[model samples]
Target: MCETNHNHNIKLDKNGNCNTDEHKTWNRRSFLQALGLVGGGSMMLANTPLSVSRPSPLSIALSQSTNENILVLVRLQGGNDGFNTIIPVYDYDVYANARPLIRIPPSEFINLSDDYAMPKPMNKLESVWGEGQMKVVHGVGYENSSLSHFKGSDIYANTNLQEDDRTGFMGRYFGEIYPDYFFNPPPSPPSLQIGSIGNLIFKGPESDYSFAVSDPRRLLQIIENETFYNLDGVDENCTYGEKLRFLREATNTTFDYAEVISAAYERSPEYTDSSYQDDSLGRQFRIISRLIRGGLGTKVYLVTLGGFDTHNNQIQRHQQLLTSFSEAVSTFYKDLAADQSEDWAGRVLTMTMSEFGRRFRENGSLGTDHGTAAPTMFFGPALNGSGFVGEHPDLNNLTRGGNVTNTVDFRQVYATVMKDWLCVDEGLVGRSLLDTDGGPFESLDLGFNCSGTTSNIPSDGESLSHIPTYSDSQTFINIVTPQTTHIDVSLYNIVGQKVATLANEMLMEGVNMVINVKDSANTRLSTGPYVYQIKTNNGDYSKSIIIS
Candidate 1:
């Protein structure tokens, strides 16, 4: 008999084993809701709304900028059993003894080298490896890893091992590149997130940098329909009717980026190749491929594949998941390669990440529990060659908790990718990764090296800073200039109309200027949301404020 435990959100049998078959019956809406995609941000895309942070004029300007390389983050939602995924050919005896029931037959796995092999279910990756487009980083994790899935995922995304930090490494990088993010967002999304709804990887200090959607079908509908929100049916007789109309109109105008997204989708050729699977992950990759081919200049994308939490029926369940993942990734690369003119395959990199690895030994239930460290896989022609980067953890040596000790710090891989593949400056990379105090982590040699790349970040002595503060029923724009330069500060409404000129004069060097918005406007202001923009010779910055 099977019993549901609402507290733990799982189903268990009389023997206390997890009901693995339940995963097979999950519908799209239930799966997405489980992933926490129900709320926050704006509602734009179809029934399943797309979460989006309102972009500023500066954001619009930055979106027009372009970068050569792109990154695709494949989030393996649950903890993957690494020992099963990457068989230890060198230590086969020890591995077999550890998981005798779940041990893969020697002949069943595809051999990569004398030291390691991949399960047969992932045979599709053999071609990717043979083409010199795939590489694996062994035992990639942080020290003192958290076994809890929620905490582990947060630690990996934020790159902070000590405590729960809301900001992510990518978010920090985006924040640094676009300091005035709250005021001026980029033209296109800085990143596009397709699953992993609640993941903090793209969360900036004040707002999330990515435009997120729960599923590809809704995103497709958005592109096809080319409409954000309909305000026609709103009843004027309803309570707060004027406010309701104003809110809807404001929301409709804010989603103008939907038109931009639709234009890009329309420009790309229709995806007619049926070789790609018609399942969840495959459909996601198909949409991503279209966006990339259609000239959507988003730099980073994150897609997810769950069901890695195989605590029961390990053999059948794991095989199915791996098979799907391998096939989807294989077809995604082929789809990109179809565009011969752009060399899209050579410019894009795909990386896989999980919260953690599973226990080194299989449990009585025939599955492994949450443990530590796993292999991180990278795929793309840009990798230049195929091979393993770190020494595999010794099977005989285990921690007190029976988990594999990490041989490579995951942050090292992130630092290397940010510095080399993304062409970010070494100094900014250190700051973004929060390793500035201890100095930047050592970057690994992952085949390619950045050359002739110059950073656009301004020096500390040349940068300007602004802070908006509310005190005693008055609004203040506190400006700290690095050196005296002409400054112009203005306020605008939700509809992009200038409402007040807060400041339009020159300030002295090393001076701190604070302007009172209410006194400076020279008119009575209503209570609502407003954007205050500061224009200086150094650069432009803006942020939103709520007047209540």
Candidate 2:
């Protein structure tokens, strides 16, 4: 709704000529018409294809099918600090020395194992991590990663390291499925962007395959009731007339899209997922979840959590962003579970993507500068690869470029998703990602790793498999689960003073959890008489562990 600048003192006639009394001023409509004819934008959608009335726009899944692979792509807008996000347990000293100003203190680190630990703020993902539902792919980047957010994001989205292609990986996928999307859009909306459509990540060869609206309810109101008023008659034979016709026709198609989106929104369930973080990200995911729960048949969804460009005062801001993201994502999965959707856990996959990562060393401004490789995380019920995927880049030995060298090619990830999750042809996936040579890029193993079980075991059947062995370095707890839920355990001195919080996490069912315990450093526990307790969602259980 940008207004065109015009000279205010001039009086003009209806024909856009200078006059004396009445001024027929130019406005948005005429400006749009001018653009329509001048740029010939109307030619883009000249022929309305017959399939506009198709069941859904670019429909890929059957409404009654429960096995469709659903992908929830999360864009981390700013460069994320991979070192801080996934603390390096092996190179703690080097990492701390590099970013002393913004490092997470050793004492406060949450122990995942002797090899790795996450920031305490990441505790929301503890349950997911424990169940092997999360995968941390480290050192994800392309060669010569761009430092500029705009350029880096484009590279990531376009998957064109050469910066030569205009089509994104997803865009190409959509284009392959719906060759003439401009003329005959899917019966239902193909892809949905929760908030602003930040980029053309979903742009096809000739047109964009997705649509975005700020609010569903408001969109419904606008499409169903709002009216557009065009100006009165002018010359029908003039250049302006033809341009006006194009603009009006384009306007009509836009209205049609609005109506389709509103109908899909109405089809979504009335109840919103309540576990969200009550922020923009949360609100957006809520919309996504309801659409899935209500069976909208949308194949792709784009969710964003921006403000990652932490060039200054990053400690608090980064933590807040991670917290919001963690809570919303963790809860979104749970919300799907609460709905008791049969295939949600197995069908829906959520992955995080970023433009790039910050430098290893802290800058003078108390924030790390933009740099290269970072970790990408994935969570879902059908995830086979959990924990760390690639070896963490050596902090002591950085590349000559002063960045963590990529351990996993970003295209490998794209190829994996295309083939494993979205079921694209392997040959198409390989070319879509790595370009001309290969038929299928190496697919990362993201299959469901844990065993499925019925959650009907009796309360008395659950217990610690054995007394956990403890030392100053660590402790091991073998907790057998009857069902999947929350579990917390702690150690106490002889006098009942709590010594260490060993495990406060969610555990999946039907697995023996060899839980590890450690303080800040990867050291064993002290020798002494200690008592341990285990708490489950069902009830509390306790045992003794004599480290001596």
Candidate 3:
């Protein structure tokens, strides 16, 4: 017979095996009280059944309606040789010469229209890229970097030069941006990281905001502990009375919240099928997509696809590696696109980065070794087109022996996303996020030069009549700065089609200079992503923003 325990929250007949509680004891009062409260590894109170259909207090407090804003970071484990991944097909002669046997024939690539394209396996991305929703940042890395896989990944993950603290740069961003969310569980699910194991990026002081969930179906098994909650034997050892009470309260509090999260996930759709690798990492991404689709309230999700440590048989292995990596990512993006969740299209941003790129030349063993400077790809929603951000160094001009000299630092990318993409303020983000051979990079300027000085300088009084503003329901984007007197701002669609003319005239050197835009009427344009470019008479500035 199945044993039942009421107050203890645990049940065992005689053999001392755990019996499922089904969260019967998770109560409403305890559940609501724990809502919106940050989490910690401490004892909690006994639980009672919560209101079935009511939203958790935490979810209500966040008021975070589905904005569709999601960040998915896919790590291509093992060293992905950049040279072959995005081979210079136009310059195939040089590439073929470098990679004699391994070079993928030009015909094999998914021809990305203008002479460049991803490998055949990455054809999935080619479709998205052609659609203008995916972006590829080429030749991104650091200078004088350690080639060790662990050290390199540390650099990518932490974005710190010395790699001292080991906290994820994203973790710090999440911690600072939503301290309460990081400290407390979101009303739906874990905020920062959702996987079988929590990453360093999700770790915070007193922060149990991360949950290492392997199976959403199994989460309830951990949440409802029948033996611990029952009033009868909770004090079986009968130690300190005060300690026992503290433990009970803490346990109850945590389990009550956990129960709510488990219930939400239980209703989420499962995406994985036999075609997926059936690996732990594969399963994790599938779950992540489900949670995101289910509106789990996760902001940044991280999952690593390992086995990139290609030392031997690097040819066959690396080929398969890239194939699997691209396939998984391509499918993931498609899944997000198919998701009917309100936030899926507008808010979700999926990106990938490695510790560093592989060496420029193949090693003696026909395999490329650890090197620096690789490309990072940002896929999904408002992300702009594909192109190399930093210049790829000449093959002959190596950094040390033959390492590709890094033109753009990795942290610059992080800072750009943090400051511009995510609206995080680097100045107040605390501590230098990336270690420069010099110091922290200038706050990640998204290449949008808004300096206060420019030549055609419109005086303060000049009515920049074209300046856009939210006069009514129309969305107007105005470019103003302290550096330039006049700047040009234009809107472009994914097809490289210039949609609306937001600003093509002069502007003053002050704040709130609104520019009236033509063709910006809500009805004229369909809901989707658009790129905004600002070309100052002095320099060029561009940023991508989504219009709801």
Candidate 4:
């Protein structure tokens, strides 16, 4: 049944879709090679088998699972400068001293309480803040963080430090939740990335869980012409031809999605308001809003906006990017909250990511260099999104070339969203996200009422650093033992509710152990306020932690 159809007087229309031959290759591999997506999207083209060895993902939603929450993930392709973006009101003097040229003027910032402030460009988000739907998780990074764009992004995407990995956090998490995705797809693609499809975030073991189209119209053109890149009954005998066949088969599936996205696009209304910027980021958010409003059952959505890597002429460039970012988010929220679809305001939680944050000190170019540890944000109506979470950035003490040490591990955020928001099972959380050598990261309590229940996870602790604040996201509980003694460190809210037990062990004499405190369901702590107590043979030492 396989035949070779060479490129000869190929008849086609405006749209790129193959009309006569839907299964022949008119040099499809060459087209893919040009874009560099084969390796990124498919991973190992010839090496890895079509199927992977793992448990079936069909039964991911167990009986005790929480309600399915929609997560809108956005990635700032280039490293973002957290210091300039999130002004350090607590240490403005030091921050200003560090970057006199690049530092955001105090007056040009929106003060978020007494401790934190954001640049004026972020001022428009005041409404989001006022609604308590803007939360800032300070100092997000991991150990041995990479400075290179490729390496750092891989670290965040894979959550694993391994270099040769194509498996992404979203891919694994979604894969488990919808094990039968390949055989029985979701109502819509489980996750839809607006721009490029070279991302591995939604990659599955045997196949990818998401779809890729540079532009809906481009795909539509390709489909409208029925110019499907056919692989001439791809014969397995020819490796290149066989590969083309495989890609052709995948492209056929892509045709299926083109129709779906086109429908969603048609359903979305035009933006008549002036709030939305006429920029790319704005356009992407606009599409996302329409898709979600159009009842796309997509559980997770990723929207990426690059140009954050500000190495030169950053003042204008950075401001523009932030402005676009803030406006896009604000406009998206407003659009969702409109009378046409008011219920989704709280239903969708928008979170941000970056490969890494720029160096603490400004470089000679009046810009910032790639560094470690930066701020990540969570915004939406449902979450108590206001207030700063995690340890505040310490400008005075910079590490390994003036980089801010991470206070809260990024994986904790994923864990929180997965367990608390999406209600994914604990086991999948471990298998999906990589944080402490493939760990089930301690869930951070973002103060979201996932099941109409109050969380009491004690907030972040602010005191002298018992443990030099590293890039890891764990909050420390310093305990110095005088003699061989048994100690118990317990977390509690102001109302005397025992929230969690950080450590319960017997220590040898004259030993100090720094414990990490995280908020989870069992040890629920709200974002408002909380306290912690450590009981030992020598007596009890207590400290306070502010969760928000």
The sequence of per-residue lDDT tens digits that candidate 4 reaches over residues 1-548 is: 22334542233345633333333333332445455423333111112101111111122221123344678888998998988888888888898888889889877978888878888888778888988988888899987788999888877888876556878887776554443344322235556666555477777664465433444455557757767675555444433444454456555655655555556656766543356788877877777777677665566777788899999889999999899999999999888888364477778999999999998888899898998988888899877657778897577788868887788888888888877887665666777875446466776767774566322221123211223222353455566654677877777543344668877888776677876566332453333234456566544445444443
Off by over 4 Å in 3: 1-68, 113-115, 177-186, 189-196, 205-219, 222-242, 269-281, 341-343, 429-548
Q: Model 2, 146-166: lDDT tens per residue? A: 899988888888888764666
Q: Model 1 clash pairs?
A: 56-185, 59-184, 59-185, 59-186, 59-187, 63-187, 183-542
Off by over 4 Å in 1: 1-54, 60-66, 171-187, 208-246, 270-272, 423-439, 448-450, 454-462, 481-511, 515-548
How many clashes show up per model? 7, 21, 53, 28
Of models 1 and 4, which has the larger TM-score?
1
Best by TM-score: 1
- Model 2: which ten-residue window has the lowest total lDDT? 42-51
Point out the higher-scoring one by lDDT: 3 or 4: 4
What lDDT does candidate 4 reach at residue 102? Answer: 89
Model 1 TM-score, all chains together: 0.77
Could you tell me how far off, in angstroms, the CA of residue 103 lies in candidate 2 after the best superposition? 1.0
- Alpha-carbon error at 357 in model 1, in Å? 0.3
- Could you give candidate 3's per-residue lDDT for residues 161-243 as a string of tens digits? 76456576655544433323321233454343433244555554324344332233333565655333544444322222222
lDDT, residue 219, model 1: 48
For lDDT, candidate 2 versus 4, the one ahead is: 4
Better of 1 and 3 by TM-score: 1
Worst 10 residues of 4 by lDDT: 43-52
> Model 3 compared with the native: what TM-score?
0.63
